[model samples]
Target: MSVNSRSDREREHFNALATDLGSVWWGSITKAGQLRLDERAKLAIRYGGLSPGKVVLEPGAGNAEFTKRLATSGATIVGVEISPNQVAIANERLIEFPKAKVVVGDINKLDFPDGTFDAIVGNAVLHHFDLITALPEMLRVLKPGGSFFFTEPNMLNPQIAVEKNIKFIGRALQNSPDETAFFRWQIDSILKRNGFSRIWVKPFDFLHPGVPDSLIPFFQKFSHFLSNIPVIKEIGGSLQIYAQR
Candidate 1:
C-alpha cells in the first residue's frame, strides 16, 4: 500500500487554516480548544509511551500547537506537516524549543526511511483518509515494536454527527472538507487488519464549546461523569488509542 494523496479541497481547506486557526470557526484556541489540548496531553502521557531520547514522528503537526507541547516529554520530536504555510508557522513558533523541529511533508508519503523512528503519533488527524490503506504505509515506516497513538473525535456524538454528515452544516462548523470522525469497532478492525497488536481504546469527553472557562472545571467533571454512562460513553467526544506494530 502507498500513502494517499491529499485532495484539492483538503489541501485548500488546511492551507487556509494554516494561515491562522482563527480563520476557521472551530480551530482556534477557544475555551474548547484549551480543553482539547489538556485531554491530548493526558492521552499522550498515559498511552504514547514517549520518553527522553526516543525519536517520535508527528504527522499533521498543525502549526505545532501540540508538537510544542510534545517537546515537554524530553523526546526528539520531528513534526511533519503537509501544509507549507502551517510548516512556516510551526517553525517560527517552535524556535524556542530545541527538542522539536517542524517540516513540510505529506503524511501519506512520509520522507523517512524504514524503522527510522521509535514511535509515530498524531491528534485529530487520522480521520482525513481511508485508514485501511494509510495504516499499512505507516507500519512499513515504523520500527518493529514502535507504537502509534492519537485521539480523534467520535462521529456518533450528536454535535459531531450533524456537523460531519450534513453538507452545509459541516461547512458552517468548519469541519474539514476531507475529514471524518471514527468509531471504536471500525478503528479496531482497521488496526487489526494492519497487524497492530496490543490495541487499546478509551472513550472520553462530553463538554462542547461555549462553556465559559470559569465553569470549565465543573463541566469537565460533568463530562467525565457522562462518559461513564452506558450508551453515552460511545458518543461523548473523542476516542483515545494506543497500539504497537
Candidate 2:
C-alpha cells in the first residue's frame, strides 16, 4: 500500500482501538507504566522549558496522558487528537483545566491559525506519518521563536529492532514499516528546511532493550543513569528533539 493509504489505515486502526479500549495502553495502566509515562512527560516539559501563561499545542495526543501534565504548568493547553474517542477521554482527563481544549482532528491538516502557539509537543506520534508532509505543518503552526518538542522511538537502538521483529514474527506480521535509523536525520533535515534553529537531540532510556515496563525498572534506571554519560548518551532507546522556529 502507498504511504497515504497506510496512514489512513493506521489512523482507522487507532480510532477503533481507542473506541473499544476506552484509552490507549499509555494511560490505562498503573504502577511502573504510569511512572514511565510521567517521566517522559516531565522530560519533554523540562526540555521545552514550558512556563505559565503560554499557549501549548499538543498534536496527536493519544488519550491525553501528557496533556494533563502540560496543563499543570499553568499553560493554556490545546490537544488535537485524530481519534474522536481519544479526544473524548482527553476532555475528561483535562476537564479541570478550563483552558484546556481537546479536539479531534488530523495533525497534517490542523485547524489552528498560523503562529498560534508558544510551544508544540508530540510524543511517540511523528513516526506514524510521512514527515515530508506533516512536519511543515508543525513548523507553520508555531509562532516566531516558539519551540517544538517531540519524542520518538529510536530505530537506531539495536535491541529495540530485535524486540519489534520478535513481536512481528510471533504475530505473523510482515511488511510492517518499522521506524528506521534515518528517521532522526530526516527530521533534522526537515526542521532545518522549515527554518527551525538550535536543534538539539538527546537519547533517553538507554539501558533497557524494550519499552519502559514493570519488569525493567532497575534496567531502566541504570540506562537513565548511563544516559548522563557523555558518550553513552548519544545512543538511547528514544530520540528527543527540541527546535525553535
Candidate 3:
C-alpha cells in the first residue's frame, strides 16, 4: 500500500478507537492493563535514559497513555499522532503537563529539524509503517548520539504470529489495516541499515493483559522466569529495542 493510503487507514482506525475506547483502545481497563502499561513506561524511561531537561519524541502517542507517564519525569515530550481525534484526546490527557504536547503529523515525514530530540521512545508503534521509509526520518531528527527505545510485538510469539498473519483475527483484535508485528533480527538489521548504532533487540514480556487479576502476582513471576530462558526467550510476546543514532 502507498504511504498515503496506509496513513489514511491509520487515521480512520485510530480515530474510531479513540472515540469508542479512549485509553482502553490499547489495553483493557483492568489491573492487568495497568500493570502492562506501568512496566512499559518504566522500561522506556530506564532504557531511553530520560531526564528532566531531555526532549523526547513519542510517535503514535494514542490518547497520550504513555506520553503522560513520560511527562511525569519532567522531560519535554512532543507526541506525534496521525489521527486528529486521538490527538485531541492526547492533548486533554496531557493538559496539566506543560512539558508535553501532542501534534497531528506523520512519523515518516516528521516536521522537526535535524537533531531535534534527545531520544525517541514509544510503545507498539513502529510496525505500523515501513521501516525502510520511516527509520531514515527518525534517524534524521535524532541528535548524533540520541537513543531509541520501544516495545514492539514479537512475531515469534504464537499469539502475535497468528493475530498478525490472519486478516480476520487482526481485524477482530483492532489492528490497523497495515500494521504488523516484527522479528527481532528484522528490526536489528533495519536499524543498522538506517545508520543507527549500539543496537540491541531482545525479546521479553509474557504477562498477557488478559490474565486474571487473582493470578497476576504468580503469572508475573512466571513470565519473568520464562523471559530469561535462553532460546525459549525468543518467543516472548514483545521485543525490547534500543539503538543510538
Name every residue pair that clashes in candidate 2.
207-223
Q: How does candidate 3 score on lDDT?
A: 0.90
- In the range 159-236, model 1's lDDT, one tens digit per residue, is 888877887898887777767888888788889988999997777888776677788789889998988998879887
Off by over 4 Å in 3: 24-28
* Residue 124 CA displacement from its true place in model 2, Å: 0.7
TM-score, ranked from best to worst: 3, 1, 2
Q: Which candidate, 2 or 3, has the higher TM-score?
A: 3
**TM-score for candidate 3:** 0.97
User: Each candidate's TM vs. the true structure?
Assistant: 0.92, 0.83, 0.97
Off by over 4 Å in 2: 1-7, 26-30, 163-183, 207-217
In angstroms, the error of model 3 at 57 is: 0.3
Ranking by lDDT: 3, 1, 2
- Candidate 2 on 42-135: residue-level lDDT in tens? 8767776677878888887867787887777787888887677778778887878888778987767778899998898867777666676677
Q: Which ten residues in a row have the lowest lDDT in candidate 1?
A: 1-10
Question: What C-alpha RMSD separates each model from the true structure?
Answer: 2.3, 3.4, 1.1
Q: Please report how far candidate 2 places residue 42 from its true position, in Å.
A: 1.6
In model 2, what is the error at residue 90, expressed in angstroms?
1.5
Point to the candidate with the largest TM-score.
Answer: 3
